[model samples]
Target: MAKILVAFDTRDEGFEKLGSEHEIIRPPKGRDFTLEELQGLLPEAEVLCSVFDRPARAELLEHGTRLRLIANFGVGFNNIDIDYARSHGITVTNTPQAVIIPTAELTLALMLDCARRVSELDRLVRRHPGESTAIGRSGYLGVHLSGKTLGLIGYGRIASAVASRARAFGMKVLYHKRTPLSPEEETRQGISYAPLEELLRLSDFISIHTPYSPETHHFIGAQQFALMKPSTIFINTARGSVVDEDALISALQSHTIAYAGLDVFEDKDIPRLPLCQLENVCMTPHTGTQTADARRAMNEEMLENVARFLAGRSDLDRVV
Candidate 1:
C-alpha cells in the first residue's frame, strides 16, 4: 500500500475508504501539519493531499522526495506551484466536480443577499431591537432579482449552474467566455452570448466566475468598472485577483456600481480592511464550499484521484 499524507486535519469519517486501503498520515485533530512536521513526513509520502488555501510551493514540495501526486481539495489549484510540480514529475489533480453545486448555491445566495439587503437589514434589526422606526422604510431599500440582467464573466460549469438558477428567478442571463456556445445550445440553456463590453454596460448584476491565472489577473479593473452602469450590483464568487480590489473599492466608494457581494479576496482568505468597512458590500469568507455536503464530496473526489493514480489509471484528473 502507498503512503498518503493529508496536509490538513479534517473529519476522520471522510477518509474511511482511503484509510482502509493505504497508510494514511495526518496531523492531530483540529490542526494542520506544521511545515517542520510536513518536511519530516514528506520524504516517505507517495501522495500529498492538500487544501486550497495552503501554499504548496517548491520549498515544501522539495521535501516530498517520494511524492507522485498532489490531490488538491478545491477546484482552484492556484496555491500550488504547478510549474515546479510539473518539472519534478509530480501530477496534480483538483476537485472541480465537487465544488460546482455548492459554489453555485452560494452564488445565488449572495445574489439574493445583495438584491434584498438581507444581511444589512438583519444587522439593523440586531442593533436596534424593537425600534421599528430606527430608519424609515425607504431608508435602506433593496432591488429585486426579477426582470434584472445577470452578466457572467465565464461560461464554465459553475457559471452555467448559476445561469440556470438565475433564470429560475426570472433574470436574464448573458455570458462571456473564450468561446461562445452554439445557437442550439444557447437556446437550450436559456442564455445569450454577449461581447464582454456590451454585457458590462447592459447588465444590472455582474458576477465573476473565471479561474485565476496570469492572463486573467486583474481581468476586471478601472476601465472595466468604468463601463458598468451606476446602478449595477457586482458579485464575485471566483478568485479575488481576477478583479482588481483597488479598482473595485474605488467603484464602490464613488457609486460607480451600486453594491457588491464577494466571497473571495485578493489577499486569499483575509479580506482587506477597507473592504470590510464598506456598508454597500456584502462579504463572505470564501465560503462557497463550506457546507458539510460539499466537504464530504470534495474528500471523496480527492481520494478518487489518489486511488486512480495508485492503480495506474490514465484518467485520474491529471493536471501535470
Candidate 2:
C-alpha cells in the first residue's frame, strides 16, 4: 500500500471505501497542515492529496522524494506547479465533475444576492430589529432582471449551467470563450456569442467563470471595468486573481458599476479592507463547493483517480 499525505482534513467517511488499503496521514481534525508540516511529511509520502489553500510550488515538491501523484481536492489546480510536477514525473488530477453543480448554484446565488440586495438587506434588518419603515418599495430599491442580458466569461460546464438557470429566469445569455461555439450549438444552448468587449458593454449582469492562469491573471481590469455599464451588476465565482480587485473597488466606489458579488478574493481567504466595507458588495469566503454533497463527491472522485493510477489504468485526469 502507498503512503498518502493529505494537506487538509476532509470528511472522514469518504475514505471508508479505501478500507485501510493505504496509509493515510492527515492534519488534526478542523485544522489544515502548515507548509512546514507538509515539507516534513512529504519525504515519506508517495502521494499528496492537496487542497487549493496552499501553494504546492517546486520548492516544496522537491522535498517529496517519493511523491508520484498529486490528487488535487478541487477542480481548480492553479495552486500547484504543473510544469515542475510534470518535469519530476508526477501526475496531477482534480475533481471537475464534483464541482460543477455546487459552484453553478453559488454563482446563481451570488447573482440573485446582488440583484435583490439580499445580503445587505438581511444585515440591515438584523442590525435594526423591527425596522418596518425601510421595507417599503421607495427605499433600498434594487435592479430587476426579468429580461436583462447576462454575460458569461467562460463557456465551460459551470458557465453553461449558469446560462440554463439565467434563461429560466428570462435572461438573454451571451457567452465569450476562446473559441466561439457553432451556430447550431448556440441555438441549441439558447446562448449567443459575443466578443469580450461587447459582452462587457451589453450585459446587465456579468459573471466570470474562467480558470486561473498566466493568460487569465488580471484578465478583467480597469480597461474591462471601463467598458461596463454603470448599472451593471458584476458577479465573480471564479478565481479572484482573474479580476483586478483594486480596479473593482474603484469601480464600486465611483459608481462606475452598480454592485458586485464575489465568492473568491485575491488575498486567498481574507478580502481587502475597503471591499468588505463597501455597502454595494456581497462576498462569501470561497464556499462555492463547501456543501456536504460536494465535499463527498470531490473526495470520492479524487480517490478514484488514485485507484485508477495505482491499478496501471492509462486513462486518468492527467493535467501534467
Candidate 3:
C-alpha cells in the first residue's frame, strides 16, 4: 500500500476511503503540519497531499525522496513549484472540478456586495445602530447591476458560471481569453468575445478569474487600470499576483476605479495596511471555496487522483 502524507489538519470523514487502502499520515486536529514536521515525515511517503495556502517548494519537496505524486487540494497550483516537480519526474494534480461552483458563487457574491455597498453599509449599521447614515440616503447611494456590462478577464469554467448568473441579473457579459470562442458558442452563452483593451475600456464591472503563472504575473497593472472607466467596480477571486496591488491601490486612491471586491491579496493572503484602510475596497480572506461541502468535495477529488495514480491509470487530472 502507498503511504500518503497529508500536509493539513483536515476533518477525518472523507479520508476513510484512503485510510482503508493506504497509510495516511496527517497533522493533529486544529493545525497544519509545520515545515519541519512535514520534512521529517516525507522520506517514507509515496504521495503528498497539500493545500492551497501552504507552499510546497523545492526545499520541502527535496525531503520527499520517495514522493511520486503531489495531489493538490485546490484548483490553482501556483503554491507548488511546478518546474521542480516536472524536473524531478513527480506528477502534480489539482482538484479543478470541485472548485468551480463555490468559487463562481463567491465571485457573484462579491460583485453584488460591491455594486450595492453591502459590506460597507453593514459595518456602518454595526458601528452605530439605528443611525440615519446607515440608511440609504443621497450620500449613500449605490448602483444597480441591471443595465451594466461585466468584463471577465479569463473565460474558463468559473467565468462561464459567473456569466450565466450575470445574465439572470440583466447584465451583459464580455470575456477575454487566449482563444476566443466560436461565434455560435458565444451566442449560445450570451457573451461576446472582446479584446482585453476593449473589455477594460467598456466594462462597468471587471472580474479576474485567470490562473496565476509566470506569464500572467501582474497581468493587470497601472496601464490596465488606466483603461477602465472611473465608475467600474473591480473583483478578483483569483490569485493576488495576477494584479499589481500597488497599482490597484493607487487607482483606488485616485478614484480611477470606483470600488474593488477582492478575495485574494498579494502579500500572502494578508491585505496591506493601505488596502485595508480604503473604504471603497471590500476584502475577504480568500474564502472563495470555504464552504464545508466544497472542502469535502476537494478532499474527495484529491484522494481520487492519488488512487488513480496508484492504480496505474493514465487518465488523471495530471498537471505536470
Every candidate's lDDT: 0.91, 0.90, 0.92
TM-score of each: 0.95, 0.92, 0.94
Show where candidate 2 strays beyond 4 Å: 16-20, 32-37
Tell me the deviation in Å of residue 254 in model 1: 1.4
How many residue pairs collide in each prediction?
A: 0, 0, 0
lDDT of 1 by residue, 113-163 (tens): 988888888887888877774667687888889999999999899999999
Give residue 159's lDDT in candidate 2 (0 to 100): 97
Candidate of highest TM-score = 1
Kindly report which residue stretches of model 1 are placed more than 4 angstroms away from their true locations once superposed.
13-16, 19-21
How are the candidates ranked when ordered by lDDT, highest leading? 3, 1, 2
The lDDT, on a scale of 0 to 1, for candidate 3 is: 0.92
By lDDT, the better pick of 1 and 3 is: 3
Q: What digit string (tens of lDDT, one per residue) describes model 2 on residues 1-320?
A: 98989898887756765567889898999988999999999999998989876789998899999999999988888889998998999999988888999999998898889898999888888898775736775778887778999999998999999999989999999999999999999999999999999999999999999988899999999999999999999999998999999999999999999999999888865789999899999999999998999989998988888878877787777777
The regions of model 3 sitting more than 4 angstroms off are: 130-137
Residue 309's lDDT in candidate 1 = 83
Worst 10 residues of 2 by lDDT: 129-138
What is the clash tally of candidate 3?
A: 0
